[model samples]
Target: MASNPPAPEAPFVPSQRSTEPFGSGSYRTDEGPWEEWNPTEESLRPVRGRHRVAKQRGGLARSSTVLGVGVIAAVSAGGMASANTGKPPVSISMPDLPSVGSLLSDDSADAAEAPTAPLSGIGVTSADTAQGTTDAGEALRTRIMAQAEQQQDQVDTKAAAASAAAAQKAVADAAAKAEKEAEAKAAAAKKKADEAAAQKAEAARLAELAKQYTLPTSSYTITSTFGQAGSMWSSGYHTGLDFAAPTGTLIKAIHSGTVTEAGWAGSYGYRTILTLDDGTELWFCHQSSISVSVGQKVATGDVIGRVGATGNVTGPHLHLEVHPGGSADGIDPMAWLQGKGLTP
Candidate 1:
């Protein structure tokens, strides 16, 4: 009751805020209840050349540019390093024009300079960089060592080849020399053999000549005497005497006389003649072989001929004929042999 509480004051009118979107990126606030809250020209208008980019995006772009610059610097450094360290130089030329020349910048001016910073954070100076020159010297030494090794290999191979060739040539020469020596030895042997053959042939010819003329080589008992009226010869005479002996018997000469005849005769085959110093002649007929030659002097007991039945005889006998002073007519051979004390 407090009088109906001031009769419900006129439905309490509260002040209303201006209707606007919550953020700038919104629907059309000017045509809606948010028109009064719309931004004015000063608020909506951007600075003439301002792009209104995000702070982080601008920073990212700057960082990307920096990284690109670093990459370019690294590439240039690598190129300069290659040029100084025995690599082929980079050449650039213009298209459709003469070849261009090169320009030396700071990098080319300090061509022999070494890097001051090490990978492990060591540093050096321009003139003091010579202290780091040990690596370059080592590289140079390695290249020289490789070249020397290659040269040595080539030399060794050539020397080995030459040695092998010399050995082969020596072998060939030795073989040829041995062959020549063998041939010479063979030829000498053949010559010696031929000379031996000639000597034997000469000896044989002399032996044959001795056989042609022979004298009685032995004394024997004369059973049927020669040149007498006896049993064998058809001319009513015996031309030779018979002596008994075994085969392979030894015989000797009658007297020391020169042989005048030997070998076969017409009536008395295998006959021999001996001429004495007094020109007296003695004949021995029917012999195997004569051991004396023509004009050969003989002594008693010398082997003049072997007894054999080669003449006209009925048995193995010695056919003898004697002549005084080489006369054609023969004398009694028995008397002649008896005079010489040869019983035949």
Candidate 2:
């Protein structure tokens, strides 16, 4: 009976999850916040399309940049190798890259239509392969630069040599020209001096001849010349020239001679024959007085006799005759005197 009475009215115990609402004093509302939740991939599908293309473009640009870096590293390595080997670098040609326009284009349809081959298929591959290509390119650049520098040096050397040669040639030419001018001047001066000397010598010779010779008389007129046509002499023609002058007029020796004869002849009165150095004889006939004796030497212009009317003369005159080689026949005295530079 007591146990039946114990279970009576067991205390009003609340359930594990209370169904009653909190009190207003705790600052709660009937519409409380829900539990925190995490979203899944499917639940975020609405925003995927907006950013997908941008992501793809960014990835392409990053890949291209990485390829460029690899190439640069390879080039640096090759340059170092050539410097150590002391050999010329190799040459490399790079393929054309995509332009900015092609890279920035967003037309997927166009990209699909073009359908270019991958980098590996077109002879470019991993980072190692790019490095090797870049190394070859660097070697080529080094070779080109070296060749250019060598060519420039050679050109400069040649220019310098040519300039030096030209200068030397100019100097030589100028020296040669100066020498030739000096020689020509000397020759001209010498020739002029020689000509002046010759002229002076000829003048002196003429003066000497004038001093050594004189006329037979001071003032006389030629009346008859040698070879004149007439019977005035024993021969067929006049054999001596007649110089008409006043009686006692002085007669002189024409040139230096020795008196060979000073005696009278049948047709000559007080005649004198003078023999010269060349065996030529000069005869002075019909003289008033004979001062020079036989075998006497007389100089030119010496008073030998005087003019008078003697044999072979018509009046007070002197007959003169010139014989070459002491011959009988006489030549014209006027012509013979002119041959000795005398204007008789």
Candidate 3:
């Protein structure tokens, strides 16, 4: 028991670590994994040649990204490494962290550290500071006044819009009413014009009737002429034209006139006298019967008496005579008939 079985065989120990950081946490190394010693600069040269540290980022975007992140980190980190000699193998702290204002120029530091001005338009006041709040009180008053004015302006704008709309509606309605009135006036004028035209046409028709008239007893051929030498005339010449016809031949007025006499005359015998508006008188002598009475309104072609062989007529004939006034006077009956549109 004291001999302990001649000391069991010792377990094998692994070789010591090399000097490379990947192998033994050191930067200088030349041996394989089994080497247990550090290396000098000459011995580590080959390992240094075998690997490389990249000089710059690959693309511009990558470079920019790296540069931006590095710059931001360095500015904010506020500490620098004190030694690069690889002694102690750890980073050492620098004493001073430069303030952003001290590290940059006055312009850059002001741009970076300056508090932004407040947004302007509605709440701005004349003063820029607010230590005692005197300016702040005035600014608050101004803002409240501006807000009230804005509310009043909104109400005024709505009222103006309503008024304008009402005015436009009224104008449109007035235009429509005026158009309707114009149409009605045009229609009325057209109707009145049509009536005037009809009245004119009727007057023209009556005038045409008066233009074409003659004594009905005339056969257009005078059997005896007035002023011709004849025994039947009381003034030594024929006092009237003799138009021979049947005893009951119809008689007609020479023109538009009024009957002045329709009774027996001393010499004319069953006579009717017509007086024209121009004061000219016409006598129908030796009428078998009178068809129109005295004072009767007679137009052209109206019957006044009949043809008969009475008075001084020797046979069935009409004794027609003219009287300038009412006295028995003689005139050419043919010429007088032509004046009344009677064509012989």
Clashes of 2: 0
TM-score, model 2 to reference: 0.41
lDDT of 2 at 172: 99
Residue-level lDDT tens digits of model 2 in 1-344: 45444456543343333243443445344422222223344544342211111123335577477557756765665565454432333433333434222333465643554332333333233764677778889999999999999999999999999999999999999999999999999999999999999878867876787788877886778788878888767787888778888999999998898999997876788899989999999999898888989999999989988887777667898888999999877899878876665765
Residue 34 miss distance in model 1 (angstroms): 99
lDDT of 3 by residue, 90-170 (tens): 222221321222222245434454333322222223453453266678889999999999999999999999999999999
- The sequence of per-residue lDDT tens digits that candidate 1 reaches over residues 215-308 is 3534555666656685456667864445634322445655667888877886676778988778988777777667777888887667777777
Best by lDDT: 2
Task: Count the clashes in each prediction.
Answer: 6, 0, 0
Lowest-lDDT window of 10 residues in candidate 3?
A: 48-57
All candidates' TM-scores?
0.34, 0.41, 0.38
- Name the Cα RMSD for model 3: 21.2
Model 1, position 164, has a per-residue lDDT of 100
Instruction: Indicate which candidate wins on TM-score.
Output: 2
